[model samples]
Target: MLTTSQILKKVKELEIKSKRLTRHLFTGEYHSAFKGRGMSFKEVREYTAGDDIRFIDWNVSARFNHPFSKLFEEERELTMMLLADISASSLFGTVLARKKDMVTEIGAVLGFSAISNNDKVGSVLFSEDIEKYIPPKKGRDHGLYIVRELLTREGKKKGTDISRALRYLNNTTRQKCIVFVLSDFLDPGFADALRVAGKKHDVIGIKVYDPMDMQLPDAGVLEIEDAESGQVARIDTSDYLVRKAHQDAFFRHSEWCKQVFTRAGCDLLHISTKEDYVKVLQKFFIGRT
Candidate 1:
């Protein structure tokens, strides 16, 4: 557990870092990468040489005996929601930082980016239930508040229930928005909810992981505790078969995650705790463009 002073110090650091990155790295890329809702008809004007003929208002044109083109404006303001997982499994890490730390940092960056682009930012922090919600709002202060919460807020439950989070999001918001589900994705049985959310909103899955979650070191027999259940089990890490089984399970879980995201028609980005997330985000933004 982090002390009050420690959490405050870390929050300040993250705010500074997120602000800098938002300005320099994501200013333009993030704005252009994702589009808002469908364009709204602004007005009708005399048809220009380059205007698309399909948009011509036949009734108006027939009445005036001249072609009229319908003009549309893009919905500039967008709402971005972050569904953050605060499960106990996020506390585990080996060679890198904890999964929770990575999620917090990435979420901060994204929040800042959204506000920088004049988009409304909101979040739902969950651990087997909806823990807290910050309604969509504009401005830098809102982003800072989200960063602070991500740094200091404690989970009420230890287990992960992504389905509950998704269902909550689906029911609460009627507006179409961009949603990012950030988690280690250790939970199962969320595919149906995810599919529903994707159909209604633009959804993205950000999977944060640690190296130890994928492989176990050969350090002889050790007692392992389940972070969510608090159940302990002794395993011989020195045994090749044990390590192999662990690796296989990890791979299978990862593969299933990929398939789930694919079936839901949502974009998935995997980030390791040890890697620089800015580069990963940049690549994703550029790829979308």
Candidate 2:
């Protein structure tokens, strides 16, 4: 548990870091990567030789006996929501940083990016249930406040229930928006909700993981506790078969996550605790461009 002062200090540090990255790294890439909803009809004008025939205004063309093309302008305002998993599993990490820290930093960067693009940003923090909801709003102050909440807010429950979070998001927001769900994705039975959410909104899944979560070192006998269930078990890591079994289980989970996201028609991005997330995010944005 972090003390209030510690939380405040960390929030300030993250705010500074996120602001700098948002300005120097993601500003333009983020804008071009995600466009607003479908273009709205402006006004029809006389069709030029190069005009797309698909956009020709047939009604106007018949009235004037000449082709007229419809004009459209992109919708400028966009809404972005972050669905964060605050389960206890996020507290486990044996690398450069904890999973919780990585998620918080990523959330900050995303919130900053949304605000920079003049998009309204909001979030839902969940752990087996919806824990907190921040309504969509614009401006830097709201982004900062979201960063603070990400740093200080702790989940009451330790288990993960991503389906509940997705359902909640679907019921509450009617507007088409970009939704990012950040987690280690340790939950089950979320595929249906995810598919439904993806049908209406642009959904992306960001999986945050720790290397140790995938494999255990040969450190003789060790006691491992499940972060969500608090179940403890002793295992002999010195046994090669035991280590292999753990690795296999990790790979199975990873494969399942990939399949789930793929079936839901959403993109998946993975970040390890030891890697620099900025590079991963930059690659994703550039790929979209």
Candidate 3:
């Protein structure tokens, strides 16, 4: 646990770093990536050549006996929500940072970027249930609060249920939002809920993991604890079959994440704790642009 002063200091550090990255590295990329995401209907006008047929106003056209079209203006402001997993599994790290630490940094950066663009930013922190929901709001203070919460908050439960968070999100917010789901993705059976949420919002899944989650070191004998279940077991890492099984488990989880996100028509990014997540985020934003 972190002391009050300690948490305050860490929050300030992250806020500064995240603001710098948002200002210099992510400002333009983030803007261009989500530009024109929210569009609002403006007015109806006579159809012109090369107008999108999908936007045609059929009823108005029939009333006037001519083709008409609906015009839309891009919404200048967008809302961003971070669906962060604060599960116990996130505490396990064998490299630069724990999964939860990486998630906090990424979430802070994203919040700063959104606020920089004059957009509203919020978060939904979850363990097995909906822990908290910070409604979308603008300003530096709100962003700072989010960073503080992310840095200090720990899971109150054991496992992760992404569907619960998604359902909560759908029930609470009626507007279309840019949603970022950050997790180790250790749970399954969230496809249906994810698909439903994706249809109404722009959703992205971020998988934060550690090297140990993929493969165990070739130590002779080691005791490992399941963070979620609090179960401990001894295994011989030197055994080839044991290592293979570990790798295979990670592969299965990765594949399931990919399939679920793909089927829901959402984007998914994987970042290792040892890697530079800033570059990965920049590349994703640029690719979207």
Candidate 4:
């Protein structure tokens, strides 16, 4: 556990770095990627030569004896909700940093980016249950608070119940908003809840993982414990069958996740600990454009 001072120092460092990254390719792309509620009328102006005929205000044009057109702008203010999984499994990582650490950094970046675009940000940090819920609000302080919670809040329970988290989100959020679900996705049976949320909001799932999650390293015989369940097992990493089985299980779970998101018409991003998640997110934003 981090001390209060250490946590605050780390949070400050994260905010600096994340804001720098966001100012680069992130914030602008983020703004373009996720659209607003709808276009709103700004004002009526004199119609130009190339103005669309549909936008010409006949009543105003007739009153003024001139061609007038209604101009509008996109309603860009939005709320971005982050559903972060803080389960014990997220603390397991064999390369680079733990899954939790990566999730925190990415979450910070997203939060800062949203606030930069004049959007509100909120979070639901969950383990076996929801640990904390930060209501959506706009401001630098709110973004900082969300990042601090992401770094300092520890899971009281060990397991991951993504379904419960999604249900909570549905119950609390009444209107449409942008929802970003960040997790290692160690738990199953969340397809139904995810589907319902997808119907009302722009849902995106980010599967954060370590290299070991997919393939076990060749370190001979080893004792491994399930981070969530506390079940221990001995396995021979030297055996080809053992390694293949480990990879096969990961593949099956990944497939299920992909299918669920696809069926729900949601977007999914796969990020390994070894990869640069910031770049991946920027690329995704450009792709959306």
RMSD of each: 2.8, 3.3, 5.0, 1.0
Candidate that would win on lDDT = 3
| 2 against 3, candidate with superior lDDT | 3
Residue 228 shift from truth in candidate 3, angstroms: 0.7
Candidate number achieving the greatest TM-score relative to the actual structure? 4
Q: Per-residue alpha-carbon lDDT of model 4 for 177-278, expressed as tens digits?
A: 899999989888889999999999999999999999999988999999999999999999999999999999999999899999999999999999999998
TM-score of each: 0.89, 0.89, 0.88, 0.97
TM-score of 3: 0.88
> Comparing candidate 1 with candidate 3, which one achieves the higher lDDT?
3
Task: Please say which candidate is ahead in lDDT: 3 or 4.
Answer: 3
lDDT of 2 by residue, 147-170 (tens): 888887879999999999999999
Per-residue CA lDDT of candidate 1, range 23-119, in tens? 9989888988888776999999999999999999999999999999999998889999999998899878876688888999999999988998899
Distance from true position, residue 70, model 4, in Å?
Answer: 0.7
Q: What lDDT does model 3 reach?
A: 0.94
